[model samples]
Target: MRKLFFYTKQQFFNFKAMQTAAGFKLLSMSQLLSSQKVGELNKNQKYYVDLSSVMGYTKTNDSQQMLFEQLFDSFGENIDFICDKMYEEDIKYIFRYIFDDFSDVDAASEEIIAEKETIIETPSRKRRIVDLNDKELDDFFKVFDASLYGHERFKEEFKKLVTAYRVFNKIGEHKILSLFLMGDSGVGKTEVARAIHKALGSRTKLAKVNFGNYSSHDALNSLIGSPLGYIGSDGGELLKRIQESDVGLILIDEFEKADSAVFNYFLDVLENGKVVNSQADEYDVNGYIIVFTSNITKENFRSKVSPELRSRFDYKGMFNLLTDTDKKKYVHFRVNQIISKYKEFVSEDIPDGLHDRVVCEVDVSKYKNMRDLNKKIKDTFVKLIGA
Candidate 1:
């Protein structure tokens, strides 16, 4: 195994240069001379000359007088003169002074390989959603607050949700948090789900299913194969993928739009953390997190979904319309993100005063929330870019 060594300036000099500078090669000779000295060297001199004592080099005591006589005659000045002048104090300069040609070559090669591996390995590790550490989580919320545009109350609610999950995780009970997010259209219901999924860290770790996709007659068959109807159809609709990703996230978009029959089965998974396949075998879903996103308001949802089904979820988050303040912030944030992202596309800075003009001209009354703003921005961009 190769090891990298770190050295302090004083220590490096003591080990690499001081002993070699003086004529003494045996350690005993240097020690006898220091002890027999009429006057002791100061801390600075000792620190400078202590190199020989630490490096295990220098002449022996039997040859000490000869070595001293040799040391005195070997140079224009005494050992003390050399000690007074320490080398220039830069790491690169110090390294060049200490490491040999072969040592330098080996160190450089090791560094190159390490850097190459880091560059090569990073992509495989990056994901759309990254779990946040304490500091990262704080930054994430701050960015999210800015991104959402004017939902200070919503941000507070989000903070509470995050805190709840963290607290639950600490107690070992938050491994699978089933959240039901109900709200009006164009707020941030779906965005919140996507954000949560991203925060968790990987697209592969998240499985998004559209309830509308399950409306067909073959939907059930697609989920779980025919009882005995076909060959090479052993895998059911999304069963294997969901099973394999036990600790992953599952987002059911437009939950209200899904067929009653499909949701009936989902009820079982939500409540019991287990799903029975067509084969009548129960698969454990204890480690899976289920997120249900709907455009319906809580009042309507309360009327639509039964009390029994509502009780299964740990929390029900309400995504309301964005306040005016949120709209301005959101617009500013989005403009900045776009400008920063496509800076190379524009030679001048963001079409000159475009952000302020858009924010001022935007019809806030017509837009209810983030979803509306996002759609308006999307349409506006198409016209602006002529793409």
Candidate 2:
């Protein structure tokens, strides 16, 4: 009797390695069992069946045993089966009864497969923002405040929003806290979302969708996916962004640029706290905080977005250019960050007071734009470090 081989779950997905070691093509056990006919096999071809998928086919032990016996009898010498480490005695008994010997692949092949265990052991993707423990929550505000400079009024309002969200989350009445920020080109409008993302300790890219690109007639189609039967109708940009993100916070930049259809779509999102794709898949955005940043003035905002939609925003505020004092604070923060990064990476140590030198050289008063100021900081660092 041919010996049956068992493979761990980690080795299943590594098709290349499995093929190389087993000299066979891999097939799912479920697919074979579900199919009405077993196709003819090539003389040299060998097939592997994953037993985990087979276990899901039936519930009872007797049924599983019967299925296993039939599968072994039908496949005969044409196939080998693989399974994750099964501890169940009944399942082991079936394997023992079917085959005379149980064997693993050669040691060299086992080593190659063992190396891939790390890939399998990796934790599943993080979907939502990890809730802060009581101690962490207490310190959250302080970190948040420090990260975002200027906008003291906006900070207080945001704190209130967060407090309300935590309280009302249980009642399920209030779903999402939506903030609409209007400001000039280079003020910290988008920074509000960034600060929150950082405070939440997100290691993933911030979920950002710039509606400026979706200003065309097909704006809604681009934001959410195209309908079925339409070309490229897989999934929408917003849904894709949300899925890729590790946190619940989403930043929609250039909100004023999108058309009416997109606006109405977001209206539903904010009210229902769910984003439904064209495919009708609903993503729960409840307890999420979405920050919408726009460059439109207050007059234009009123004229462009309807009053009904305007009223739905939890907080609407205009972000102003940072005060000189706040600008200096930003300079200090940026300088320290650059210096720390420099110290960590660069081996050459020139001056003890490089941070002070760099900060003093950057003239915050000369630039009103944060982007320009950031450029100045980079320039100053390059000049000082001679990198």
Task: Please give the clash total of every predicted structure, in order.
Answer: 15, 1
Which candidate number maximizes lDDT?
2
lDDT of 1 by residue, 1-387 (tens): 111133334344333322222111212224435433423322111111222232222222334334543443332222321111132232223223232221110012334434544553232232212234665566446435433444466567667866776666556565556778887777776665555554433324556666667665666666666566566556575566564342245777778775555667777777666766676666655545577888877687888777777887777878777777667666655654454345536643445555555556566667885666767876665455442
Candidate 2 lDDT over residue span 86-140, tens digit each: 5234346656667676654321244554553434322223322334555556555
lDDT of 2: 0.72
For candidate 2, the per-residue lDDT at 23 reads 34
lDDT of 1 at 20: 29
Candidate 2: where is the Cα deviation over 4 Å?
1-130
